[model samples]
Target: MSRKIREGLLMLISIVLLATGGTILYRQLLPSSAVKADGAKSGGQLSVRHAPEPKADVQGRFPAQSVERYAFSQEGKDLFSLLVARYQDSIGLPQSAVLFPKDAQEIASSPTGLRHDIWQSAADIIARKAPENALFLSWWDDGQRIHYLSGKEAWLRKPSDKTFVGPVWKALQDSLPVASDEERARLAQMARWLTMDSEKALSEIAAHFGASRPVYLLVNNDLLLHLAEFTAYGGTSLSLDSKNIPAGNDLHGDIALVKRWAFEAGDGNYLAQKEGNYYRVWSTPDAKAKNTLLVRLLPFIDSLKKLPKGVSLVYQSHWGGFLSVYKIDNQPIH
Candidate 1:
């Protein structure tokens, strides 16, 4: 070969060798699933599972006496029992259903210790009370527990899901009392769309969910208590406290003034003291202030007691009222 040609050939071979080594290294670093045809990440993506068929036998396991002491009311007891029974059956231990702690003090002392157990209990209730293919509507936080523990379907598994960007999510966001009059009006309209006892609104929601799957509204008590924080901060990372409230903001002064006034005024709508460092304040029944979605939703939730003819409060429990299930009796398409 000519000297120039030999040199050029050597250069080309070196470049080829370097490129081959780099490609091999890159593939080795990539996750197994990432190299798949679908380009999914290994163990990083959630797998969608088929909804389980409802079982009639599961209902028989829950007895009112079993959960009576754990619950506050007869309805609460029955619901609690049903959830416990459901959880027991779900884990393939039909004979060993989990029950609430016999001593209420134990729960009060260490609520955090029982958090997962509580979640599992709530999941059981959802699994048993809701239909086989029921689609639960609730905040994204509870979606995973309902899905993995209960084997039920949820509208959105996480807040960042694209499905959260539409009217329903917007309505929920607008439902917060922290906005303009026009915004509040929009919020009111949306609240009515979901929670109103009107046949038309109920029908619209049913249509939104479609005919094949029933829609169950799941309300977590903790979610209701901290709704203001959720609305303002979009998560539990922030709370309504003196430290969290920005300096010069009206809310800080308002809360302090409300706390002072509560000592004299006694319990009323505008201010009330909670068990711990928490306290609640609102502008008035006629005019709700910003960051008070929880306060606003409370009365609306109470109104569920007298639901329209077709709607029903299927379940409620005492453990912080941790779970409330509402069913809209719209016929399923399937």
Candidate 2:
């Protein structure tokens, strides 16, 4: 695990986030000026007024209609509705059926679906460019995909007795529907690897997955929305506070109402939202939640200035910049 991975073909990452075409202005925030004393500080706690605008350039930039489409978009809604035509009893259509043309277009409009291109792109990289017999580790979902498409070995394929429940709450998430014992202890450890800070997380990943072959970690950008879902799994304190404002007659009033919620930017919190169903903002302004592995891996949505240590930005899809691959550095296997 500590030895250097046999030098494999490293596919340089193409910074093509704006592939859909739009002026991408990587904002340069005035460090101290990004926040101002607007008579907003209260009880030694910071308020939105202290930092009225987003402190960092977040990934959920209210996606423009013509650009990238997610499962939560209007188009995604229509595709998902069509995809779920048969499965009336439960949400098994996506699991059992093939991802036809609709899958490429984004059918699962819930918080978890992404354009198939990202996964396919990463798979292509591993299949065509990466070295043979290299080991890949990731959240089980993408890990299984990499193994299948790339023909590479992905660790922790399936966790048993696990079920997911997704809800729409003004960008906020609540407890999922009851299910049989959801034992995701190992998967929870993977989540922890993503949520842990750079230093510790790097060591942990190497210890658990490193070997003579190269170990690559595949991550999707959509996990930014999954912040709340895996808190219990990773045993982290970070929280994603969400709020959705349905387009209504009370435009101004609702707009003002939208501003009120668990939002505090000075604490290094960013806001993201879904404009299709609602003016839904995906926000989690936890002052202490900035430097997790999840945030650094997917800078497309979350607010991380740079990628974490002990990982190299090996590849990124040229089509839709929704997923990324990282080559883990050498570390002692504990």
Candidate 3:
């Protein structure tokens, strides 16, 4: 062979050897699952063995029955903590990923139960539309579910973070049967603050947390129904007398002393009269003489309709408008 051809052959041999060695090293560094084992001979053919099913780490873990029993126990703090931690680790998720299963289950099983599906729908919408770090502002009662399902931080994470309740109460007080436009304006201002969409409202909310961040507001039909409890009317327990007044009772004299207010309900106008046990509301003007509890709640209900200019209703559920999502347009205040 020529000397030049011999040298070229030697170089080609070196290149082949280097490539084989590099491939071997790469295989050795791969994960165990990536490495294949020698196959068994079956019917004159090599058959590769299927990967073994991974054995779950059952050690130091409670059985399914124990978990179920613990779920029903009164002192389940430890169990809940453990389950929440395990769920996070296993799913590679944050604490907000775990729905407040206990509360959701309880509500589902109640007589006046909320349909869990509705909550899931709302959560889905929030998760899709809300920014990653958005901080939700809502009644403290809804904090847990919002945090868990939406995977977002809530302003009212605990009962103690309910500083907004005072302002809400004041707004409710202003909403009472007073005949002053100034009182109504004050009530409107408080509503804006509670919704946290205006500059003043944002400043007040930021003061509580010591910083400002993106915020979203969630509302539902239950919120409308129980508006009084979230306002000044909620401060005192309501009681009713056993005496039933006639349907044609003089509302100005008999019912006006308690509370009387009108509000828009759906397409029609309605009046609420609250006196003693006779808390009744009706759309028909003929039923105006009857007393109702809804009378005191008209202001709060009306406030729900008056969102700030930049706040827009982005989502509404089909189920009796039970779920609503409002988005605040982030813009510089002129």
Candidate 4:
């Protein structure tokens, strides 16, 4: 009731209020996960920020050469093209999606025989615009090695001699319901290589996997080896073979043979017989080729001294994809 008592009570209440406010402010400044909830839902409120999607430059696989230009030349450019069109137009089939039923069915019908052009087109598009974080699909390659590439690496694999393509036939069976005699024959052939040797299969397949991206570049062993060396040593530098070719155990089985084969193949720039340990500028009509080549050579120049006697070398240059070669210093020049 007294004025001094009234003033004293008001001051005490203000001090309590200040203490409460300060406690809240300190909690707010605490690191997330450190802050305790005051009877809030599941701990506390989560501050969410809708970040803009990463503006990454997407890349896709482009056909290095037309289907008609390679080994399947005589089939007529239209033959394989027509096949792709039929697969695309088929009912209950998928146009382009990883492990889609339609794609599986198409593989079932023609296990070792896919339209290369269509595959390349689909692959390129998928690389450029990745709709998902991961993609998985079983593929067949007859006895021929399947080659898939992405970013800086390439994979080569040959299916077992007896595995039939399962998904393809499953799709076909789903749509056709009743298989004609010819369809049955195709199905049988597709499943011929179904069972696999788990050990060898796993070991061989494991080499192709990459940490950053999934495998995409698929080709036969011959083509795969050719491309690997091309991409590995900056598009087949001239120096790779010239210096290291002589210092091997055997001519046929030595590193020299690898170099020779690479050169004999297309874009044999792996043997860069240049005077300096630097890459040369080079270009190709094929963007995939150019990119692979560039990434391969950028490392060799920096580590030239440590290069193995039997190893290949690709150097970097001012321009892209061009290569330079050097031999190991202690290699026996036989």
Clashes of each: 1, 8, 6, 36
lDDT of each: 0.37, 0.44, 0.35, 0.24
Query: What TM-score does prediction 3 earn?
Result: 0.38
lDDT (C-alpha) at residue 139 in model 3:
51
Tens-place lDDT per residue, model 2, 1-334, is 2223211111111112211212111001101122112233333221121121221211211211111111222211222210111111122211111111223333223222244444555566678777776777776545545554555766644433332322111111111111223426667777777777756888887787657678887776556555555665654856545554564555444434444542443342333333344554444465346666776666423343346678877876643345667888932111
Error of 2 at 89 (Å): 30
TM-score rank order: 2, 1, 3, 4
Error of 2 at 171 (Å): 23
Worst 10-residue lDDT window for candidate 3 reads 21-30
Q: List the candidates' TM-scores in order.
A: 0.40, 0.55, 0.38, 0.17
Off by over 4 Å in 2: 1-114, 164-185, 243-284, 300-304, 318-320, 330-334
Whose lDDT is greatest here? 2
Runs in model 1 lying further than 4 Å from the true structure: 1-110, 161-203, 225-284, 287-305, 308-310, 330-334
Candidate 1's TM-score reads 0.40
For candidate 3, the per-residue lDDT at 311 reads 47
Instruction: Provide the lDDT at 90 for model 3.
Output: 26
Q: Write the per-residue lDDT of candidate 3 for residues 222-282, one digit (tens) a residue.
A: 4333333334422222221112223234534433322232223232233232322342333
lDDT of 1 by residue, 1-334 (tens): 7867765563343222222211010011112221111122234321111122234323232322221111211111211111222233334532212223323324332233244455656677776666787887655445534655577765533332222233223222211213344533433333334333245555666676666767876664344333332343232221222211112234345345553543343332332212212233322333222123333322222232234544456665443233556676733223
lDDT for 242 (candidate 4):
21
Kindly report which residue pairs in candidate 1 clash with one another: 211-333
